[model samples]
Target: MSTATQSSGTGTGTGTATADAADLAPVRTESLAAILVAGERPPRPNALQASLTFGWRAILKIKHVPEQLFDVTAFPIMMVLMYTYLFGGALAGSPEEYIQYLLPGILVMSVVMITMYTGVSVNIDIAKGVFDRFRSLPIWRPSTLVGYLLGDALRYTIASVVMLAVGLIMGFRPAGGVQGVVAGVVLLIVFSFAFSWVWTMFGLLLRTEKSVMGMSMMILFPLTFLSDIFVRPETMPGWLQAFVNNNPVTHLASAVRGLMDGSWPTTEIAWSLGWAGVLVAVFGPITMRLYNRK
Candidate 1:
């Protein structure tokens, strides 16, 4: 008899073969159907741990591309040195006096400027298709941005230290003792962290890394130079002075200068913190929304 006909019989070998085929058919069909229907869900990660993992990943990226740090390390030092020597005499009577006054302002400006890089980096990652991989992973959705912010904190710290060290070498002194310097540093880090959310939002909205960088400079220049970073706002036209007086950068600089000078900075500190809160409240949700949509 033919093998096909034999396999269909109820006798010993044929019975076993028929039974095996029956068992295997359903399994194969079900498995294929399951695959076509839906994939198994990946396990979710703990929110905090996932975010830190992302943060560590960002830190590791710098090892492979150390030039990523040029802005945080080199530019701030250049700004402190060049501005002190070039504009010190013209703006603050002498470079010596300007070093003291301008150092605090430069410190603030440097950290704030560094915030732009956060946006550029975010945009680059999105453009490179890395964010799509992140989306496919089972981690918390916001963890990627949170981790990036954490990594950028390291950048902010390095920039702050570089600015302070360069200032001291150039004869800048803080009248506020150790306690005051610490407070100023804490405030600077906090403000920079919050300001980063603004850039993060811009990164999500913009199409290209170059556009993000260009727009960031456009926004930051008015906020920094138009305020009191290099010169007294009062020296400007009255209309300009009015805007400077209300500028958030003005409050941040005033707060930093006050802390370093051992002066009470109740109003400035309050305003600085308020601006930080406002930036977080407004931009943070928008960034997350755009990220989810993208």
Candidate 2:
């Protein structure tokens, strides 16, 4: 019995010692590498792919926090209703007649106003340090900024569509038919996209979201309100008319209004396109520089 017990104890001790020796063995670089990367690494995403990825991320954020859509939906609905009824009778003698003139302008105003939120989003992301991780990635740099604009473009579209629905309900008819209406909306969205770059630059330059918002409102209020949206620039004082006439918003509003009315205002369209190009050319570089430094 003693001999059998001794043998059993010896076997157990040897097995335990062997297990520990294996555990303490140094891991080889090859083995470690194999374990760390189980397969071939993925290729770095190209600019378009990267940009689209970030854009999708923005959309996902909206999906998770759907309340972000309130500005696009509720605010637009309110603006259309309040302005159509409030100004309709006073401005054009009747609500129905006024809607025909007001809807396109209102559409431009609402979408342009919401473009400021792109800067707000950039500021928020910077605050949360989300951008830090983005910087460390191997993707295209401008993709992040472009992604925000693309996502906000969707919001612009939503606001435009909602406002149009409300306008139609309010008796705003576009003489340009569906084709003209579509063209007008497309032009507005393009301008809004270009305009968003301004806000993006502000977002990079400003330390806080509120600061960006305040600056945007200060600039936008004058541009939108002083233009031919609510009243004709000809009715304003001479000096004020000069500013209103040159305002990019005025050109955008005029272009959109003309398109929707089937008038095809070539001068307005050219001016609007020129302004859009100028915005992207000027602000886009500044924004990218700020983004890289920030």
**Over the stretch 1-294, how does candidate 1's per-residue lDDT look in tens digits?**
698677656477777888899887755777788888797766667999999999999899987899988988899988988999998888778999998889889999989988888888899999999999999988889999988888998988888888888888889889997788889989989999899999998898999998999999999999998888788777899999999999999999999999999995999999999999999999999999999999
The best candidate in terms of lDDT: 2
Q: Give a tens-digit lDDT track for model 2, residues 1-294.
A: 999999999999999999999999999999999998998889999999988888888899999999999999999899888988888888889989888888898899999999999999999999999999999999999999999888888898899899998888778889999999999999999999999999999999999999999999999999899999988787889999999999999999999999999999999999999999999999999999999999
Candidate No. with top TM-score: 2
**What CA RMSD would you report for each candidate?**
6.3, 2.4
Q: What value of lDDT does candidate 2 attain over all alpha carbons?
A: 0.93
lDDT of each: 0.90, 0.93
With a 3 Å backbone cut-off (N, CA, C), the pairs that clash in candidate 1 are none
Q: Give TM-scores for every candidate, taking all chains together and pairing residue i with residue i.
A: 0.84, 0.93
